[model samples]
Structure formats: C-alpha cells, structure tokens
Target chain A: MLNIGQHISQEYNDELEDLRNQVLSMGGLVEQQFSDASNALLNGTINIAQRVTELDYQVNAMEVAIDEGCAQIIAKRQPTAIDLRNIFTVIKVVTDLERMGDESEKIAKFASELSADTNSMGFYKNLKHMTFIAKKMLTDALDCYARLDAKKALEVSNMDAEIDAEFEILNRLLSTYLLEDTKNIESILKVTWCARSIERVGDHAKNICEYIVYVVYGKDIRHVIDGKLQDDK
Target chain B: MNNNKVELDQQLSETVGKPLINGTPKITCRDVNVFYNQDSQAIFDVNVDLAKNQILAMIGPSGCGKSTLLRCLNRMNDTIDGCSITGKISLDGEDIYSNDIDPVLLRAKVGMVFQKPNPFPKSIYDNVAYGPRLHGIATNNSELDDVVEESLIKAGLWKETKDRLNKPGTGLSGGQQQRLCIARTIAVRPDVILMDEPTSALDPIATATIEELMHELKSSYTIAVVTHSMQQAARISDRCSYFHLGRLVEVNDTNIVFTNPEHELTENYITGRFG
Candidate 1:
C-alpha cells in the first residue's frame, strides 16, 4: 500500500543530495570565475585572465550536468511541491551562473588586451571599483543561495543600483577622456566595453538574487507588475 | 527521499486504530489487500480517503489491482478463498472487522457498483427497490415507491424511467441500465459508494453522463472509483491513488499526483511506461 508515510529508500535520497551538491559546486565555480576575472583586471595579470577563460569550459560542462541531473530526477523521482521547486531552481540557477561565467570570461579577455597598454587611464580605477562591487554582489548572491536567505537576496538587489551608477559614471568619464585625447580612443573604447560587460555582470547578479528570492520565498519577483515586489507579507 | 520515507512510515504507524469520525475518513483504503498464496500478488494495498463528501479515484493498468482493492472496502474479499487482510480499515470509529460486525450490514453503509451494468435482471422499479426492500429500509409499497423514485432522481434517471417502472431493467439501453444500477446502489443510501470501472462498457455520451452524475452524488456521499482511463480519474476525482504490482506507488491530490507524481513508479505509469 502506498501510504503517505511509507518508507522510501536511502539510495533515492542520496541521489537527490548528490544533485544538490553538484549544483552548489557549479555555483561555487562560477562565483570563483567572477572573482578571478575581477582580480585579473585589478592586478593587470595575463595569467589570471587565461585561467578565467579556461574555467568557462568547466562552467559550460556543469550547466549540461545540472540539466541532465534535473531531467533524471523528474523522470525517476516524480518530485512534488518543494521538491519540484528545488530541482527547478537548480536548472534556472545553472543557466544564470553559466551566463555570468561567460560575462566573466569576456571581462578577463578585455583585461588581457588592456594589460598590454601602459596607459594609466583614470577610468581603470573606476573599473576596478565597479569590478570589486560587482564581484561582491555576485559572491553575496551565491551565499544567499547557499544559506537560502531571502533577506540577503533583497540586499543584493539593492546593491545592483550602485553597480549601475558606477557604469553611468564610467560611461561619462570615458566620453570626457575621448574628447580630451582622441589618440587614446582605442584604449578608452576597450575600457568602455569592459565597463559594459561589468554592468551586464551586475544585471546577472541581480538575476541570481531574484532566483535566490524565489528559492527562499517561493515567489517569482521577475517582471514585477506596477514596479513593486509582490506583497509576500 | 529516505528521510521522507521514514517520516511517512512513522505517520502511517501513528494513524493505526484511529477511528473515522462521523463517516469522515482519516484514511480510506478502497480495495486493499494481503495475499499469501500467489507467486506475485495480484492485489495491491490501495489506499484512498473520501474526505466527507469528496470523490477519490484509483486508476492504473489492467491487473494493477484497482478492482481487487476496491472489493476489500466492505469485506467483499471474504468471499474469495485464500485472501487475507492485515490493514486496519475503519468507518466512523468502528472497525468493520470487529467480531460483532456483519459484512452484509457493512456493505449497506458502503455500497458498490460494477463496471458492467448488473441490474438484478428485474423490473426498472424492482431494481431500484431491491436494496431497500432487502434491508427493509421501507415498510410498505407506497414507502418503497418513494424510495425508488428518490433513488432514481438521485441517480438522475427518474424522469426517463418513471413511465417505464414496470418495464424490465434489461430492456433499457446500455446507458440507462448503468443508471439503473447506480440508482439501486443509491437506494441503499450508502455513506460511501465504491465504483469499479463504472463506465468502461458505456459509450462516450453515457460515460460523460455518469461522470457528471458522480459530481452530483459526491455532494452527499463519499465516492471511490477505480478506472483504467487516467483522464477519467483526473477529471472526476479530487484525490487519486496510483497502484503498481500490488503496491500503491503514490496517492495525493489529483492535480499533483497526475501532473507531478512523487514516486518513480507513479510517474512511469502516468506517462505510459510499463504501467
């Protein structure tokens, strides 16, 4: 008889736990990539940039692994309610983290190219600041997911505004630098592109935070109607 | 999943001997089984709870034990040789297995309808009046007439069969005969009605009528039906149980069990796997 309280096997639970661990490992790797790329930009190191580029493949593989794991769980376990939510969250988080990994690699590539130039661009300082904050936001988003903390996720969303403001400042500073020294336009353009890439990373971090909110609160905050977080209270 | 299984086992153990209050089941097993004779047991332990006035469905492949388990509700399996029951099944604080209890009287409280329309091969009115007359629910012919008309009306076939009360029940079409059978079951005024593949022999229109009738009947009587069609179970049941290989794989709210089953066996069966 299939009673509500009947004993399920340990093998099934272990499999689910293993999948959860795999997703968390993937999240950790993507967060590490984000940090490595930012550190490369800060230190102007080609080796760290090269490492970030190489890790993108691992992130891609993890994405495929997480997708396959979720499919197997849905096929074999027939999870419901909270269990369903957990598998779905893993799927979505892996996708967002993969995109974040891609953006980080782009940042690393931009850093490697800019390392060859000796120009002491003032905008690099602002880029460093942006990268630092963006990396922190990404890290905190991952932490929120690991702890399943909804409040920390909301804090990460608020941090996105600071990254956006930094991007706007970087844009204005680059325009000013271009007009003052037209000969340095190529270098300034690289800086602008890197800034845009960092801005995109910030957006993805916000998306991760939103996903964390979903995991913790079971609410979809994306495309919030009327510019308000739905009244979850 | 292992932890959940242990917790669920604990919950099931805790529920043992808890009586159903006021005909409301804390848990109802329709066609539950315990077999000691077969190489592979044919009947499964099927658990279904008809909460007060709600409808529950037992659906799965042929030989999945949907019908065998349904028959266990009123100790219908006592008639079958070599069948043993170990599970504690109760109705309103009274264990049906108590020594003082009678299977025939228990069946009166929990009536059953079969897949093929078995109308006792009697007249239309007689078929409707059979159960009440046998149980002595009415004292006179006039009281019997009231019981028959009320049962037919409750079965939604009174207007169609009113003028033909004297006609043989076998003369009606397949749909009308099934309704007559339903009216007979209703005449007993059972607290819960057990239906085993109630529409498998009927046409589509007849099936639709029966399904609609079930919705109306559930307002007053708890119902547990076993069907081969997953769609029919999803359509008419508030809750559903999926059985496989003499074991209940899963049971839950119909929407979740159908759309997102929690057991591998249930998902495989629902998605047309090995059934």
Candidate 2:
C-alpha cells in the first residue's frame, strides 16, 4: 500500500488520505451494486433487480462528489509526482466505476424481463458461471486498488480474458437454444443481453485494475499489448 | 522503508537524470564543488548546463546550496571570506574564473537579481543607466537614454515608469522595484540573467507578472532562477534541477520533474513529503 502520509503538514496528509478513502468507499458501493445485480440475474428476483436500478443514482452521485474532491485537491495542494498520479488515477477509476454501475443496471433490467419464465433458469447455467468469474474479477480489482498492489492488479487484469472466454461459451450455447426452437427467441435474447452486460462489467473491472497500475508505477498501461509495461517486462 | 533509503542513497551518488543538455550550452558547470572553509563543504560535485534561450530553475529546501550555486555563476560568493570553489564554470566557452578574465566584465555578461528588491537609491532612469554608464556601453546622453528605455521596456516596466523616470526607484512597489532591478541588470546587455527568489517578497499578481516577463525574456537570453516555490519553477522553467543536502539529485525537463521525477528525494521535496 502507498504511504501517503508523512507530509510536513498533517492537514495535507489528512486531505490526501481522505481523498483515497473516498475512492475506496465509492468502490465498495459499486462492487455491492454489481454483486446485487448478478444475484438478481441468477435467482430471477424482481425485487433485487429493481433495487439495483434505484441504487445507480447513488453511484452517479458518488462519481460527481469524488470528481469535485479531485478538483479541490488540485486547486489547494498543487500535488506533484506520485501525489499527482494518484489523484489522476482516482478520477479515471471513478468514471469506470460509474460505468460499471450502468452496466450492472442493464443486467438487472434484462434479468427482470427474464424472470417471468422459471424454465429460463436452465438456460442461464452458463451465465451463472460467467457472473461468478466476473464478480471475482471485480473483487480482486478492488482489492488491488485498496492495497496499491501493481502485481495483483496485473493478475486481475489478465483474468478479464477468462470472463471473455466464458461469455463466448455462453453465446454459443444461447445460439444453439435459439436454433433448436424459434418459440423461445424472445427470452433467449434477454439472456444474451444479460450475458453481454456481464461481459461489459468484466471490461470495466479490467479498466479499474489498469488505473491501479498507473497510480503505482506512473505508467499508463492501457492499449498496451499483453499487459506488459516497459520496465515491468 | 529504511532499506529503501539505503537503496536511494546508493542511487543518488550521481545525478539521476540528464543534467547536461545536448548541444552547445550558454553556461556550463562541470564537477563543481563549493567549500566555506577547510572543514565545511557547501556543495558537492554538480554538473549542469543552462541551454541557450531557455530558463533553468534550481529548486530545493532552505540551505540546500541552491542560492550558493546561483551565486557561484556570477562570482557573487567571492565577497564572502574563506569561501572557495573548485570547478570549471564557463560562459560561452570561456572560463569566467581564469586569471585573464576580469570578474567585473564577467558580471556584466552574467547579471543577477536578488531575493529582496535592492534597487539603488537613485532615480529610476539612473538606476537603469548605471550599468550602461559603468560598462561604457553608450557613449552619449541620447544613447544612454535609449539603453535605459529599451531595458525598462524589456523588463515590462516602461509603460508604468516612463512618466516617473526621475522618481526614486526605491519609491516603487515591490514588484515594480524588482522589475527595475531586472532592467538595471539587462541595461548592460547580458547574455544570461540569474534570479535568486526574485518574487519571494511580492504578491501573487506581481509574481504572475514576473513569470510572464520571464517567458518573454527567454527568447533572447538564457535564464537561471533559484526559487523555493515549486509551482513557480513548474510554471516558468524549461528545465529544472533538484538539489538536496549539497548534492545535485536530479535534473530533467520541467514537465518530467513535476509530473514524474526519477529521484526519490526530488519526489519527496516536491510532494511535501520531505523530512
């Protein structure tokens, strides 16, 4: 973890610590929203699905609050070096977290539509597996952010591939279900939409992990091949 | 963390970034060391270059030898008893400390402004004309008037001080006085200007004015500034050097120094993590 304290001014140290804690607090909320949305999809619970949609406004509010905090730090502290990088990373990570909340809400909307037919639960076995992997990826990415562990961040970022592969398998299974009977096309499409939303959640989790690496190493690893940085390699 | 300190010290035995710029520099200091007397050392081996037509800012904590090194550039430290320097400091390929070189003439080429506004107790016009008259730069009164007006204009004080040319320079505001001092330095047409905390005694508006003037001045002369304000360095300098405990810790482009300094000491200082 980064030692952000040791500033000559204790108040400045407190300000930086408060800023980081605010980011973690926002991450916790977003992670809970994702988990709740995943549970609604797996269990076909309308109440939990509606709850996810309502909670998205809170996530959006957190993004705006955290963005204002960053602007305040830049104005008052004039942070440089790692302090500057950390604030910049927090701004980017907050955006990804908010988008993740949006994706989770999409999953909940589709999950609510698919809840009418309990027989559709059998088709979601593959989606259930994908949700498990994606939720774990998000958990690990948040853990990496809290600890400032670049190595673990890289590991979590690589796990996005596993989520992607699971999505592909789920897509193939859904295609077969569609071809076998045209009667279930409408329900199968909802399942496909839920699966796509889960895949997008994994991508957003990967983005958060990349931002952690940026804060620790002061290097932007986005769009880089194989997740290898120049010095890390 | 203690182990990291040991590793950092080992790394800091030499400068961490490119201190010597490529191409012919306006001023160069090679293997420079300063000593106050036989037993005490004020500066370690520092090798840096001031590129032509750019501003180089030297930044560090108080008593870190940034001011000492700035004084060495113009031999301002020569007045201090028992002070000695060992290095090759050259201006335009000629050693300034050589026996054949006159310190008076060298000072004219490498002029300086100080922390406090120390304009002489003469009129504004005379203060600007003092350097030219002393150096015999202008032969007649009209030529001297031209030099004074041009220097004041270059320093961004002509519009404000033109009507009051006969007023005592000491009667102006702190910022204006500093600008008048700058005009006095440039009156002799120096190739380089050294400023030691030139805006330390001024307000924000004044500091902004001087920073803007420095940006304009860089097109014609090389500038080296010693400042305690890291924001000032970030705003005005093209290159920046970080010093710590009498050692040159790092030197790099101003953007790199502020955003991603390579040396830990520089990072700590700039981020307010310094002990």
Candidate 3:
C-alpha cells in the first residue's frame, strides 16, 4: 500500500500521501485517454478524434505538476529509503504515461484521416486487437504500481512480447498492402503510422512495469533477459 | 498490549552495524555502553568510527541516545553524578582513558558546541581568546591576536564581528553567537568537534550558513554532530549513523543511509514511520 503514516509530524505524512495521490490521478487520466483514443480510432469520428488531441494538453500539464511535486518533496521532506524509491518511481512513471498519451493522440489523428473513406474502416480489425492488448498491458502496469505489486508488474512486463509480435504482423501487413495497392498508398501509410504509435505505447507501458519492479524490489529490471534481475542489496 | 509493545521495542532496539570500519577513523569507539546509577542504562553496545576530517551526523528521535553517544566522544557524560561509561575509545590510536591523559587536556583537543548558542558574557574577542588562553596555543600577544582572527574567520564570523570585537559576546545574533562558540572551539585547534543540534535555534538562512561552515571546517576538523534535523544531516554529513534506544542501529555513507538504509529500524526512523 506504500503507507507512510506514523510520522512524528503528520503534515509530512500528508504531503507524501498527496504526492502519491497526484501520480495516481495522472495515471488514471492517461488511462482514460488511452481508452478514448482507442474508441475514437475504431469509430473514426472527427469529434472523438478532436477530443483526444485536445485532452492531451491536460496530460502534459499533469506531468509538469507531478514532476514539480516530486521536486518539492525531495527538497522539503528529504524522503529516504522506500519513500525515496517511491517518489523516484513516480517521476519516471509519469514520463512514460505522457508518452503513452502522445501515442494515443497520434493514433486518433490517423483515425481521423482514415475516417474520411468508409472502406478504410474495415482495416481496423487488426488495429482493434492490437489496441485491446496494449490497453490491457497498460492497465495492469498502472494497477501494479498502485499496489506496488512486483508479481503483477512482472506479469504485465511479459505481456509486452505479445504486443511486439502483433506489431511485427502490423509491419508486414502494411508493407504488403502498399505493394498490392498504389492508389491507396497515402491512407495506408496513415494506418502504418497508427500501428507504430500504438506499439510504442506498449513499449512505454512495459517501461513503467520495469520501474514498478525496481520500486518493489530495489532491482533494475530494464534491459534484462529471461526475467532475471540482480537483486541489489 | 504490553507484550506487543515490548516486541516492537525489541525490534527497534536491534542494533545493526558491528565494529563499523571505513576511512581512517579519527576517533574509534568499541562496544561502549553508558549507564546512570548502575541500573538505568542510557546506551547499549555501540561502536562507530568517526573518519578523519569528515562529518558524521548521528540522528534519531528525542531521548534516542544520539546525544548520549555524542557526549561519549568528549566524555561530557562524566560530569553527571552516577553516570558511568565502559569500553574503549581511542583518538589517533592513543587511548583517551589512559591514566596519563587528563580529561581537562583531552577536552581541548576534542571541543564541543551545544544545542543553544552559548557565548560567554565577555567581549567577543575574549570569547574566542579564552580557549587559546587556557591551552596556551598562542605564545605571545601577536600570536594570540592571529589565533583569534583565524579561528573567527574559519567559523565564518570574523567579517561580521571584527569591528565589534569588544562588544559582549551575547550581543551578537543567535547565528553569530553560535559561530563565536565554534570560533572558540577552533582557537584551541581541536582535532574533533562535537555538535549537539548546533542550529536548532537559528533561522533558515543562519542555519544554512553554519551548515556551509561545517563543510569548510571538515577540511581540518573531524565533526560528530547529534541532530534531530534529518534534512540537515543528509545535506552536511559525509557519513550518517542512526541511533535508537541506546543501540547503534546503522551507519553508512550519507547518500546510502538516506536512499537505501540497511536496517528496518533505520528505515522506519528515517522514513518517519517510527512512533
């Protein structure tokens, strides 16, 4: 739970709790943005696409605010040990969240471009499946961080491989489509860009999961092979 | 409830570091214990090495034995009636408890600054000159004047108090007064300086000045500061030792102690999870 009560000074406890709540709120906002952008892309509605782009500014603003909060806590409270790790994790996690929001906005813009042609909507089945898996990975990543659950974070981290494989399929399909059809090249390229954006979002989600593992176990799990991390003491 | 509290107290009392060894220790303490009236114990088996020309801050809650342990460095606890200290403490490889070693002379080499700014009600110049007068550090009038000015300069107070050398030491500001005391300590050219919450009374700006002075001072004098201010300890000290219930809980590099403490008791104390 990352509970930090019982401090001699309760206000310090309150400030730490408030910082965590702010990060969770930002994560929650990015999570909603991910869902809305997915819906906007599949539906190819201009209104929803516009909403997705506009909402990104909020995510960006939250990142700045949360970053400032972390700085203030470090300067004022001088958190140590697990509290320091938790604050450091929040700083790293928010960067990933903002990047995820950026990808979602990019996907929405692609959806807006494709929506102009009714036939292009049929191509969304693969994108739909990809977004579904990516969103699930992101959800699990956020949940594990909220709980500081290393086990769940590892699970979310493993799911990134599936998204990576799907993205390979995406890259293949996009190249093949371009080879088969010259007239629809511009619109097909938008689809390819959208797929790449969503795949990058999956990578960022995986990065967040890695940070969660570090926070929980004090071990850097990034760039590791076969789920192995040297347990740093 | 009683049993649970006892268990929790036992957990918190579990000492972590064993025969702490690091950089060339200026003052080495081994298995030191303090007791009042032979029954009321104030400290447990504690061992720490205060590295040469470095600052080691000892921190914990109120009555956590941080101050008691700091006092052991200069044997300040010996003055208290019924207070007894056991175990070995050496300075520069020489046993401080040796029969030939005088406690009065030992204090000159190991000076101390108290929680409050205690400037003797004498002239500012005399306040700084008192140590050298007693220790005979300066041979002549010119040498004493040089000593007074140098010590005040090192304390970061010479510029402010130079013109007003004859003013009552108590007339200076709280921060200036603390610096004056520090100057007095340095006049004797002490090898080690023990500070007991040296800046708790000063304003933030003043506290900052003393903290900065500590950095400059560590180039010559080893400092062991007992502070309730955690942030100050993190900012100024080279190493940190967390003490709780008379037991030495942990000692490590200041950065490591602040970011990745080893003991559960140390963790709980620094993280403010302690009661």
Candidate 4:
C-alpha cells in the first residue's frame, strides 16, 4: 500500500519487504495447519493430525524471526510515519496469527484421540460447518491484512458471527448426544473440545481484522464498531 | 501588510496536514520570500509562527535556504549588496521592515549567533560588555559587570570563564567560545535570539550542554534555530519546519514532524531518503 521501493535506501526497503514476506508465509503455514486439522477430524485420520503438530514449529519459528527483524529495523532505520504504524501492526498480527496456529494444534491433538470414532460423531454435521467458517475467516483476514483493506477486514469480522452460531448448535447437539448415551461420553467430550478450539480460532481471526482496521485508517475500531454503527443511527 | 496575502497564502502555504499553532506568536513570518541578485530565489513564500517562549527549528539538507530565512528575522542580510526580501515579518504585531525602524536597533532586539563563535579580539569581559555599552543599557561600570555575570550564567559558561574574565574570548576552546558568543548575545537582553547552526562545530557533550541551555532560555526569550542536524531539531525544538529547495514542505510539532511527517518530501528528508 505504501509507495514501495521509493525509499532512498534500497536495503531498508528490502528489509521491509522481507518482513512482509515472512508474515505472509507465516499466515500461509497457519492456514494449512487449520485446514489439515479440519480434514483430520472429518476423515478420521491420525497421520494428518500428527503432521499438523509437526508444522506448528515452523509457525513459531517465523514469529520469532519476524519479531527480531522488526526490532532490528526499529533500531537501525528508526523508521517513522506510515512505516512506524505498519511495523507495529505487523507485530500485533504475528501474535494473533501464532495463537491461531496454537489453537489449530490443540484441535489436531483432539482429532488424533477421536480419530477412530469421528465417523460416529453426533455433531459432525455442525462441527464441519463451524470449521469451514473459521478457516474461511482466517483466509480472508490474512487477505485483508495483505491488501490493507479495511472494508474487507470488516467483512471478515462479520463472518465470525456465523462461526459462533454454528459452534452453539454443535454445543447443543453434543449435550443431547451425551445425555442419550453414557458409553460414547469420552469421544463426545473430545469432539466438543475440538468445536470450542475452532470457535476460538475464529475469534483470533476477528482480532486480526480489528488490527487491520487500525493500521489502515489510524482508527481503533475494535470493541466499538458495533456501538459506532448504533450511534450512526 | 501585503494587500494580496490571502492570494499568496493559497499559492505558497503547505502544512503538516493539520494545524500546529500554539500559544501567542512572538515572531510571525507570513508569505516571506528571499532572492539574490534579483534572479535566483533562495526562499519562496514561507509562512511560520514562533510561539512565545517556544523554540522553533528550521531544518533541511544543505542549501535549502534555512539560513537565508533566519537572517531575515534580524535583517542580517541587509548588509549583502544584491539581496531583497518581500512579505511581512512582524515582531509582536509591529512590522519589522517598516521604513521608520532602524536595522541597528532591530539587531539588538533580535540578536543573532553565527555558525562559528565570533567573539571579538577584546577580553571576554569586553565581549559581553560590548552590547550593553552600545545600547546604553547600563549607566555605570558595576551595572555592566552585573549584566555580564548574569549573561554568562544564563549561557551556561560562567563557571568555566569567571576566573579568566580578562582573557581574550577567542582563546577559549571551540565549544566554550560558542557559549561565550551566546553569552555576548544575551548581554543585550534581546527579545528574540536567532541562532544559525550554533552547535555545528561542537562535540556531542558540548552540543548537549547548549541544547540544555536552549530549553532553560526558552522561558524568557523566543528562540529560532536553523540546524543541519535533524536529530538536534527533534531534540530541542517545540515545533519544526522542513524546507525543500526554496519552498517550505511541512511545518508541525517536533514529535509529529519526526515520527509522523505528513508530506512525502518531509518524510524523505527526516528518514534519510533525501533527494
């Protein structure tokens, strides 16, 4: 969004580009982790869940590298103006993205434990719907960040309500399934935990969207966009 | 005042993308321009305000006309053969360029310190006493002595030079000599002090000492400085103005100017992307 490559120092410009590229790739890795965790639950596969666990290391490493890179730029270049806002936004987004990956790993662990019984999951229909919304929200949140588009970021935040609704339906169905049978109690509880983990991932995506609004408009629209819309009326 | 200032302001004024005025202005420059030899323009319709008891810094790359505008404040460029100035520069709402105003009296009211310390060959005591004597500020020898001691203390140089008051001012170290020059400027009790690269020749510690003096001095006098060090401007100035070529690109609070400059040219200069 900044008039790129026009800074007098080419190395400074290159370093900024490297930071963006690292953050985007980190987002890419987290997306894959979420997707794989979802498929492992739907298909009753333990190997995909194990792979999700292994890929967590890459996301964590990217966060560390990007944090160090941001500190270096602040120290050496003392970047200011739009550059300062953008760097701070990147720092915040990386934290949110890393936590999103952590949530996906938690889901994968539960998926591995419930792998054999996933076909008989009473709330599988609702669980699939919730994961689909959460994963789509993550993808679109990162896209809004990459483009610095506040409107698209607000759209991603709006989609989170859908994930929350589906999660509620899954919660109700899990309670009904547990009450109907005592033998499947352990597997049903694991599925409920997975659904809650996916719901939290959607929340993290919404948080990322709030930060996008901040960096783009220099306005902190978090916790107040709904109130502002009310006031506008 | 120029009858067409409204039209000129529309053509020449550029800001920080926000208003930055504070307090009451001591020196107000409006649509001011400077030219040499009637052909080459050094400053182009610059407008700025030096709020009372605040330090305003003018900064840019070399040959950006910062010094030209500084000299215009005290009419220092009047000594040049082919230089001319246009637009209104007022001190407390009184136009400084009026025909009835004497440039010599104006210099005492609006004092200047140069890039290098140019203390006289006379004794340090005389260098500080010279201004008081010219304006007849003191009626007796002891009165002049009191003024000299007070000025040296204000310039942060009295402790270093009190014992050697009778020695030549030029004999001091480079930083001390600059401080001595500042002491001389203060001896006259000017309303505004115009500093042109006042700390360029000093070491870092000496620069810091002068900067500290500037903060202490601002409570009493309106100070304006033209500096090549962008960091120094950020450190000492309440407000900062960035000049490019012959035009003022941006003027704003120092924090905003350094951390969040509005114009592309100002951002480029402060961020070392200068073209």
Top model by TM-score, which number?
2
lDDT of 4 by residue, A1-233 (tens): 53434577989889888898898999999999999988888777768888887889999999999999999999987776556767888899899999988988988898888877743565777888888889899999999878777677887888888998888887887788789888988988888888889999999899899887665444566787461323221
What tens-digit string does per-residue lDDT give for candidate 2 at B1-275?
Answer: 12122235475559877899899999999989999986889899999999999999999998899999999998999899999999889999888888898889889999999999999999999999999999999999999999999999999999999999999999999999999999999999999999999999999999999999999999989999999999999999999999988899999999989987877788889999855
What is the lDDT, from 0 to 100, of the residue B197 in candidate 3? 97
Cα lDDT tens digits, model 3, B58-86, are 99878878898888788788799999989
For residues B145-253, write the lDDT of model 4, one tens digit per residue. Answer: 9999999999999999999999999999888899899899999999999999999999998889999999999999999999998879989998898887878878888
| Candidate 1 structure lDDT | 0.76
Tell me the spans in candidate 1 whose CA falls farther than 4 Å from its real position.
A1-233, B1-33, B36-49
Residue pairs whose backbone atoms clash in candidate 3 = none
Candidate topping lDDT: 2
lDDT of 1 at A133: 85
Question: Given candidate 3, what's the lDDT at residue A140?
Answer: 90
Which residue pairs collide, candidate 4?
none
**Each prediction's TM-score versus the true structure:** 0.56, 0.95, 0.88, 0.84
Name the 10 consecutive residues with the lowest summed lDDT in model 3 chain B.
B1-10
Model 3's DockQ score: 0.45
Ranked candidates (DockQ, high to low): 2, 3, 4, 1
Per-model clash counts, in order, read 5, 0, 0, 0
Docking class of 2: medium
User: Candidate 4 chain A: worst 10 consecutive residues by lDDT?
Assistant: A224-233
